[model samples]
Target: MRLLYSIVMLVLTFSASADISGRVVRVLDGDTVEILQASRERTRIRLAGIDAPEKNQPFGQRSRQFLTRLVAQRHVRISGDERDRYGRILGTVWLDGEDINAVMVRNGLAWAYRYRGKATEPQYAEPEAGARAVKSGLWADPAPVEPGLWRKMQKTPE
Candidate 1:
């Protein structure tokens, strides 16, 4: 049974990890965008491996603006597998061969995504560290809040 489950998981991973190329039609936020494919289909992509500040959070607009400057109306390639609960494709966005997801973290505009308090993408650790050391972007805040924690705080009754 374990072997069968492993095989199924492998198949699902491969099927989901398709490469997509399209023009970035909109920058929804620091970590999300709308891509217009050649087929004229619009797909919402949630950048993999990083979580940017929420729209109302400090430096959130700047994060979005920076991402816009990087990829807005530009052609990009997305490589990833899986979708979020909201149906946004989870992918690494590449523009001019640069990893936009890593850029966001390196610039301190976003945090390396974590699941259960563990970093999901180890490669981002060094960049995030460097950004912190330099006090870049949101890191300049004396006490920057992680987006996840901020969300939970928002839901708690005042």
Candidate 2:
């Protein structure tokens, strides 16, 4: 039974790791984009390992604009892992070998979003630390709230 369980897990993992390539039709925000696939199907993708400000949050527009400039109408390679709760593919976006997720964190346009009790990407930490140390982009704010916390605060009646 243990062997069977391990085999099942391996199969599931492999099945979820899809290699998708497409042109970015839209930059929904700093950490989300719409890709038009080679098959001519469009899919929304949420960038993995990072979260940018919500549209209504501070620096949100800047984050979106920055992402647009980086990827809009550009062909990208997506190393997808899973579908998010919202049905958006969760993946690392690459453009000419550049990891867009890491770039966002390095530029301080997005946070390295690692949930407690979840596996964290070691590659994400250094860029975030460097950005924070230098007070770049959104980090320039003395008290920048994370996008998750900012969303919670918005939901809680002021």
Per-model TM-score on C-alpha atoms: 0.89, 0.87
State the lDDT at 119 in candidate 2: 24
Write one digit per residue (lDDT tens) for candidate 1, span 24-136: 99999999999999999999999998999999999999999999999999999999878999999999999888999999999999999899877898888889999999999
TM-score of 2: 0.87
Runs in model 2 lying further than 4 Å from the true structure? 1-15, 117-119, 156-158
CA error at residue 95 for candidate 1, angstroms? 0.9
Evaluated with lDDT, which candidate comes out highest?
1
Residue-by-residue lDDT tens digits, candidate 2, 1-158: 99999999999888778589899999988899999999999999999988899988888999999999999999999997788999999999999999999999999999888789342666888898899999998999999998988888878565
Candidate 1 residue 149 C-alpha distance from true site, Å = 0.4
Q: In candidate 2, list every pair of residues with a backbone clash.
A: none
Which candidate leads in TM-score? 1
